[model samples]
Target: MRLSNRNKTPFYSFIYSLAGIILVLWLIAFILEINKFDVLGDKSWVLLFIPTVMLLFLYLSGRPIFEYDSDGEALNFRNCHILFLLSQNNAKDEFPKYKLIKYNVVNVLMFSTLYVYVSSKKSNVVILKYDLTFMTKKEIKDLKFSLNKVVKTNGETSKDDNTVID
Candidate 1:
């Protein structure tokens, strides 16, 4: 269950591209205002602050947020779920020991949209959009089914009222 990925290079690249675009736009604006310093108005500079904050947020969010163990436990972003079990029982043969789940930008966008839609309807499931790219759609669905089965099996055993060993 260990999730491994090529270090955050690609993730960093995406962030850099996003931030660079914002920065370049800001720079161009600044350059254009070189001669007309006051043309942007005192409050005009405030506009750049939005992008600055957004850049910071993007940088922070883009960092690796989860790492899974071979045992199926995961260390989620913020590490509160370090002990949380993402899967039950170690993976069997033909299954990868570690799967790297990177959240693709497109998936992130979709997740965000879905989150908003679901939340508006007050759905019980809290969908966290981070690190969603690591697993393909099929893989994610399969993992969910497997974990549910494991939980159900364990739950039934715990609920049994009487058990005797010969």
Candidate 2:
């Protein structure tokens, strides 16, 4: 399924993150000013650089993004940053991001909480619901069904009863 145009993040999240960062930086600069420390005196703009860089990184990364297509027997997702989850190989473990836990614990307008289970016996990946905010509602449902079915069928699931998440 394709992501809807409406899947883009609300403007407030950016405003919130930026505003919070800027406010904290301004506070720090103000404190320094009280100490007769000219924050801008020695290319200390670099001090300001820290939060500026952070905001840019957040702006660039706050958007959810993914490109997917079928790879014969498996799905190939390019730049699936959450899991780096794509490959030509059909092995259940080879396709990268292992599982979409089949259980959505929480979902809200500002955020969501999905307990994604990666089957890798190696490194771990950490992700937040914000990462999936770019996907449309239909796309999210389709993905939940697709990934849960795929992982369950692969026999990686530990539960005896299917009890798939809806």
- The candidate that achieves the highest lDDT relative to the unseen native structure: 2
Clashes of 1: 4
lDDT tens digits, residue span 57-121, model 2: 54444334434443345444432322122222212222443343334535666443344444344
**Candidate 1 to truth, TM:** 0.42
Query: How much lDDT does candidate 2 score?
Result: 0.48
Per-candidate alpha-carbon RMSD to the true structure: 11.4, 10.4
lDDT per residue as tens, model 1, 27-102: 6776666546758666666657777887666533432333333354322222111112432322212222122221
**lDDT of prediction 1:** 0.42
Clashing pairs in 1: 101-134, 102-133, 102-134, 103-133
Q: RMSD, model 2, all Cα superposed?
A: 10.4
Model 2: pairs clashing at backbone N, Cα or C within 3 Å: none
Q: State how far residue 31 of model 2 sits from its true place (Å).
A: 21
Lowest lDDT 10-mer window, candidate 2? 83-92
**Best model per TM-score:** 1
